[model samples]
Target chain A: MKTENFYISDFCTLRNGKVSKNGEQVYSNLESENIKDFAKGIYKFLELKYPKFHKMDELCKLGFLATEILFQDMEKIDENTALVLSNKASSLDTDRKHQDSINNREDFYPSPAVFVYTLPNIIMGEISIKNKLKSENAFFVSKRFDAEFMTKYSEILLETEKATNVICGWVDLDNDKYDVFLAFLSKKGEKELTKKELNNLYNQ
Target chain B: MAELKEELKEKIIEQLSLEDVEVSEIGDDDPLFGDGLGLDSIDALELIVLLEKDYGIKLKDPKEGKAIFESIKVMADYISKHRTK
Candidate 1:
């Protein structure tokens, strides 16, 4: 077995999931049943001040805020940091918003602000733009969060000399529900990042 | 003209998401674009939509927006004469 000597040095879990890092939960409202409200609660807890965050679609905001939490603690960042995020809806939340704007074309014109986020990758672009990290990025449309696929792909990025670190996760969002879990994978941890570890972290 | 300019300033702030700006700070002669208010091209399009939706004014050409959207006073003067809604 070729060991990549990687580890998920840092991570952030959002939405309704239960996980604790640094003695603080990223989002602690597991029983709220209102995902949108939970996302907002987490954003406020983080006290983010990016004005553009208000303009993003809910899905993009979820992903962006989660990535903000994940990147908050990191001191030094690699230039070739990569992102491999997936979502079951694949921008459907924003797509629906865009559709609503156009559906009422006779009454209201389609808004460019809402229409611009009609792609799933726009979330990644938002993160990339905020961080000024222009690394290799890919947004996957999956039936669900495939831990094995995320684990393997990020490992490949490390082995093939593509990225020094991989930010991988699932940012799934619908009308009032969202599940965003992001992890930073780097080969400089105490232990290697494995499928079992990713599965365990994701299921948390 | 005073009331029209005041209303136009409010509309510009609401339409352009200039949350940090207050109507009192915006002079009637201040440029709406560039470093004056720091509005961009997308804001110009939104202003066009604002005219059509609220005042029933449709600009035939995008270039016409530059002059019309020069300032709150100018926009108010245009809308006062052209407003259908």
Candidate 2:
């Protein structure tokens, strides 16, 4: 197996009503403990007016807002860039809502709006539409964030030239508890995409 | 008719999750889909569900929605005539 080093060009994390980039804080919402309000605060802080944003579920909002922060000061993401995201909950938050809409025999109201977000990969779709990225994308469901898998999968895309860049991270939300860590990877950057570095960034 | 229109506008906003749109902003003849309100096919389904859930009016033929959902006035007329609840 040929091993080649890749660099994390930029990264963003959204957790606990706070948003950070490259280990520095960009925005914080101490007042709003709810992920919905926190994500909305980030959107307002960024001054984004995308109307579709209001329609996304909680998990998609987290991933979408994190990506927005990740690319705020950077150039437009390459259309050839791939997206590789993993999350533990896998849209369970929205799934429960959708299920509840039909759980009652008397008040059954299965909303298409909520049902459309039952899958985890729909977040990738929202991000792709916003960034206009038409590259390879994958969503993995795991019990926890697997730094090694993310690193290796992203590296394979970079090495094979299948993508000029890769956006990799964990965007997990369940029961109002959420964590998002997005890293943009390419051939040139200040930090190498090693397992240790990825884990450290995730922990940071 | 005027009262029903007002009620329909409120229900549409709440049912469709039109968070940014105001009740007064939706004119009687404003298009519900495409450029008028920026609604999509999913929203179309949502409108169908709303018709059944709120007004007890099930849309037997989905194609009838285009004309009925064309505007608030049209939806009010349809619901007033067809609503069982």
Candidate 3:
């Protein structure tokens, strides 16, 4: 069954110490150049209460914050809302920290908390746990944001009844630089979920 | 004992990234897991590493963590009694 009509519903982007939803600037932190501080700023700005947010690595924090911004005004999405996120770095930021912990044999102290987030898919898990989303989830690693792939994959999930809705986009963080563009997709919205539209929103 | 309790609270906060929680907020008898201080199993693992890495106390039995890490006071007592370093 091919489901044709799906809208992009709403979208949010977090990059360069700022957050925007549907091309509108919602939050900005120009004072903090540090990525960790920027993430903490966004968490505080959203007034999020989940303590687990602090435990998340930089990649998960970026994705989690973007998802929170995307779902801020709307009611909770259903459990069938699938998550499809792609990134370039693939948890390299946390991987570096974990590597450093075990790099020296004599000074080794590998933390389980840091070890758990060594995979990029852990970001989706964090989002799912927060929103109670239990549908299909996939984390893809590519050279850059693949808007076309995201659109096609999300469409298949909606058409197959595997997901009533989807929260999909690019969430990549490497070094101190980060880029996130998360969109809420459903049968209702202002813009259609096309490759072109997704690319435009991602670049926007 | 009082000094050890304070140090344990500080170490737990630092090790576990309990950023929002302050050292003063945690009580001496507040349970470390499941609703008291809300520390989870991963934190329990961190406490184990903390015991070994910081205090030079190697736990022979994993079950000892249940009683040893019950609270700030309990952890302090256990560390004081068993710590090698």
Candidate 4:
């Protein structure tokens, strides 16, 4: 299979508890409570734009947002599609809190809630539940965001028929800031995917 | 007695990250794991630590904790009997 077409549906960046673009407030509706709230806010924004999806999870939210913006009637896309996600910090917030509990003698017992989020793949699990997808899932850490890896992996997924479609991108959440960019790629003859096309779709 | 249970609930809430759960929502006899508040194995471990830290009750085996931690009521009773503090 070759990529037929691809698109950039929706992207969100939350910084300092506010949503902004180029230092200008585009939307600001973040309540600083926990990571779940941040993840939910991103989900809600995308759900509003694409109402077809019934469940909302971090990874599914990213995939839906990208698909809605890029593909038309994304529900028509095959369900066996693969997902490739990359992040700089792999649940560091939860890891740090678990470490903090161990560091202090008084609070020597680590909270299990903090420990659950330590794995980087939890986001993938959330997405899978949301989309009802039982597809190949992978999570990788890069020193910095690597767009090339995403492009190459997506290509392999399509060419190998492991997936007719691939949803891939970078999602990183830190102390008070987060950034996400996702794209839905299909086989070339079935869709339009080129290096320049993908660069333009994501680089923005 | 009520004050201690209230404190325990607060500690449980903070430790578990039960963001949607409130202090008033937890019943005195509510099961702390499986069905009532929907806690699981990881939560059980956290409660074990809470017992050790707050009441100086060290459970040598995790299996021993299952019966003692059936619910907040059971947990409170066990702590009252075994607490060094």
| Reference-based TM-score, model 1 | 0.85
Candidate 4 lDDT over A1-204, as tens digits, reads 543345333333444445533224554555648645654575465455332232232333433444344333454546686778887877775677678879988667776656666777777676565567778889889976677777777777767778767777777766644666666665443325556655554455
**Model 4 misplacement above 4 A:** A1-27, A30-79, A104-107, A187-191
RMSD of each: 3.0, 1.1, 1.1, 5.6
**Candidate 1: CAPRI quality band:** acceptable
Interface RMSD of each: 2.2, 1.0, 0.7, 7.6
TM-score of chain A of each: 0.88, 0.97, 0.97, 0.69
| Residue range B1-85, candidate 1, lDDT tens digits | 8988988889878766665689999999899888688787777888888889888999999899999988887888999999999
Better lDDT candidate (2, 4): 2
Model 2, C-alpha of A100: deviation from truth (Å): 0.8
Lowest-sum lDDT 10-residue window in model 1 chain B: B12-21
Per-candidate DockQ vs. reference: 0.37, 0.77, 0.88, 0.28
Candidate 1: where are CA atoms >4 Å away?
A1-3, A17-41, B9-31
Q: For candidate 3, lDDT tens digit of each residue in A1-204?
A: 554889999999987888999999999998997888999999999888988898889889999999888888886678999999999989999999999999999999999999999999999999999988889999999998898899999999999889999999999888998889999999998899999999998988
How far in Å is the alpha carbon of A30 misplaced in model 3? 1.3
